[model samples]
Target: MDIGSEYLKIVIKRFKEAKVTAEKAIEQLTESELFWAPNEESNSVAIIVKHMSGNMVSRWTDFLITDGEKPFRNRDDEFMGDIQTKEQMMELWEIGWNTFLNGLKSIEEEQLLKTITIRNEPHSVMQAIERQMYHYSYHIGQIIYVAKFLKSSDWKTLTIPRKK
Candidate 1:
């Protein structure tokens, strides 16, 4: 395959891995634990998931033709910790990932060099993909950290154990 095709495949794989890692961490938490924040200033796992899902939906829907920051997206509201149940949180997560993954899969090799706008700022398709990948990775790390803290002694290793 050409480099562009290879790159797309690799990005998809990495995104999937990130999603699974976050979900594994999330699975270890109770519903109440998902909404636990260390302090008033910090966000709960639920808030992070809400923000990530909102971001994904806004950035991925009509990704090429429209600006990534959709007019309807209320980024501020995503941090409000509105997700009340595990089912609701998972639903939002599925919607966001489905929109993003489907959009990513639809890109053609030639489109990689094309410019797109996010909040009216120009970015090459490659740059946009890289940008979201980093953003999601950062949030997923937060989710994992919070899960580890909440689970304490019960936390299962998502990867190889520290000593192993």
Candidate 2:
């Protein structure tokens, strides 16, 4: 079976757009700013990316053969802001992005129809894509929002809508 290139293309495009947003947000941040959590219970952007990496790697690596939520995912520690440096956070993002993109590039048409189990719940491959897209975009929005708050007057607008 063949997963049509068109569908994969759309999914990849959305994912890339989110990556662009994340990069822009990070670029606006200083090293000290990355560690600033709004409150004691909140996470910084660094913490979010670390969690994203954990989610992506577990959910995508050997994706079809393994459970989406891996035994290795430390869901509780994600809020710890464990990635204390810019280098480490970016490296985690790279790892997650590479793993996810590679998996998307290889998805088979058969897999698109096959029911895949995520945390014991079954979903078609397309649904999984939708789920992850929403998940990532939600977090991307958080990154952008926090960056803007930190920037205040210095922030540049990122997704200007084109009036048609």
Off by over 4 Å in 1: none
- Residue pairs whose backbone atoms clash in candidate 2: 2-109, 3-109
- Across 1-164, the per-residue lDDT of candidate 2 in tens digits comes to 33466788888988988898889888999988888888987878898888888888988988787779889887887777667689999999999999998988889766787788789898888898889999988888888889989999888778784472
Cα displacement (Å) at residue 19, model 1: 0.3
Which residue pairs collide, candidate 1?
none
Model 2 vs truth, CA RMSD = 2.4
Candidate 1 residues 43-100, lDDT tens each?
A: 9999999999999999999989999999999999998977789999999999999999
Clashes of 2: 2
Worst 10 residues of 2 by lDDT: 1-10
Off by over 4 Å in 2: 1-3, 161-164
